[model samples]
Target: MFITLVTLLEEVKDILKLHGQMLNTLLKNDSMPIMAIPDGVVFPLANVEDVIAMNEKCSDPEFMSAVVAMVGDIGGSSLEDATRRMMKFLMVPELQRHNELAATFNTHSQSCAIKHRQQDTLEVLDLSYNLLEENPALLGGLEKLSTLILDFNNYNSHVKFPYMPSLTALWLNKNKISNLPIIVEEICSKFPNIRFLSMMNNEAAPSYFNGGSLTQYVDYREYVISQIPSLEVLDDTEVQEKERELARKTYRMQRIREGSRKRKELHR
Candidate 1:
C-alpha cells in the first residue's frame, strides 16, 4: 500500500500521521521496520488495517452474529473466514440454549427465592446432569446470577460462555473437558469475577478421583490460581495466599514472554 503511494510526501504524511512529528528529532535515526516503528504496530500495513477493522466490529457484539448468518450462505470458505465456522459447528443452536435453560430452571423454580428469573432475581442455578454443550449468550439475561453448576455435562475446550460478571462460583465436574489452557482462557474471559471454580473429574483438571497423580493436581491448581487472581477456591481446595504468591511467581516470567508473543501477532 505504501509503495502504491508513488509520491515521497505521501509516505512521509503516513508516517507523520502515526507519529505526529517524531521525524523532527529522529531525522537521522528513522531507520526502523514499519512494525517496530510507532506505538504497537505489530503488523505490516494491510494486516494491521484488518486487525483494526475487526476490533471495530467486535465493539458491536451483534455484528459478528450477523456475519455468521451471512457467511453460512458461502460453503468451503478459507480458514480466515470471520464466521468462525468450526466454532459455530461445535456450538448447539440458539434455540437449544433456551431449551437447556428451561429444562434446568423453569418459571415455577423461581417462586422459592427468586422471581423475574431471567433478570436480577436468580442467583444460583444448577444446570447439572443435563448433557449440556453450549452456554449461550441468552444466559446473560440472568443479570444477578452468582453460582452456575454444570456438573456432568458435555463441555469441552471449545466452550464459549456468556459474559456473567456477577457469577463467582462455577462447577464443571465430571465433564469431557481437556486442553487446560484453552478451557481456562474461555472461563476467565466469560467469568472475570469468578471466585470459586471447579473443573474436577475432567482430564484437564486431573485429581486422585480422576485417576491423576497428586503432582498433576497440585500443578493444575497452581496454574488455575495463577491465571485467575480473584479465584478464592479451585476444585474444592482453598487458594491460600502463599500458594497464590508461588503460582504468580512461577508464571510471571512466562506470562511476560507470552504477552510479547501476542503483541508480535497482528491479532490477539
Candidate 2:
C-alpha cells in the first residue's frame, strides 16, 4: 500500500509539471492566457481584465468550482496582433467558444493581413473596415464557413467570390463596387448553397441595381436557385414562400434544359 501511494503521488506531480509547462508556453506567447486551474477543469484566463478580476475575487472553493464549470461555456476566442494597442484588448476567449472570431488588419498595413489560418475549424470571419483590393485568397479555402462579414472593407472595385460549398450568409456592404452582377452570378454559378445574402449599401451601377426586377442584374442569381432548388431566403429576408418555390422549380427545369442542349451541341 505504501509503494502504491508513492507511485500515484509521483504521477500526480508529473501531471502538474506538464500543466505548468503548458501555462508557461501560453504566457510566453502572450496570445493565449496563462491558466492555473486545478485538475479536471478549464479556465480560460482571457485578456479581459475585468473578467479576470471578477474571477480572482470569486476564487473561493464554491466560486472556483462554478467558474471552472463556466470555463467550457466560453463564447469565442479572438486572435489579435500584439503590436496594436487598441486591437490588443479585443482578444476575448468567450468569442472563440461561441464561434465568433473576427480578423481585422490595422489601417497601417499596406497589404491585406491575415493572422489566423485554422480553416477547417473556423466558422465566422469578420474582415470589415480594411483596404484589401485583391480579394484575399485565404477565404477561398474555408469550406465550413457559415457567415462572412466584409462590410466597410475598401475593395475599390468588385471582387470575385470563389467556390465555397458551405457558405450560407455573406455581407459585402459599404464598398466602392459600381457593378457586381457578374460577381453575384459567379457565386450563383459556383456556390449554389448560399441562402442569406446582403450586398446593400454598395453603389452597384444603376444598370445593375436590380433587387426585385429581373433584367437589372446578371443571370447568376437565377442560375444558383436553379441548381439548389430549396433556397428559402435572399438578402436575409425570406421571399414570397409559395411564389419563390414555384419560381425556383421553374428555374431549375430551365437550367436542366439549357445544360442538356449545350451538352448535345458539344457531342455534335
> Model 1, 77: alpha-carbon shift in Å?
49
Q: What is the lDDT of residue 123 in candidate 1?
A: 82
| lDDT, each prediction | 0.60, 0.48
| Model 2 regions more than 4 Å off | 1-114, 205-230, 243-268
Give the TM-score of each candidate. Answer: 0.53, 0.43
lDDT of 2 at 234: 51
- Scored against the true structure, residue 224 in model 2 reaches a CA lDDT of 35
Tens digit per residue, CA lDDT, model 1, 113-192:
22223455878776554456764455777888899877767778888788889999999898899899998999889999
Q: Where in model 1 is the C-alpha error above 4 Å?
A: 1-118, 256-268
Pairing residues by index, what is the TM-score of model 2? Answer: 0.43
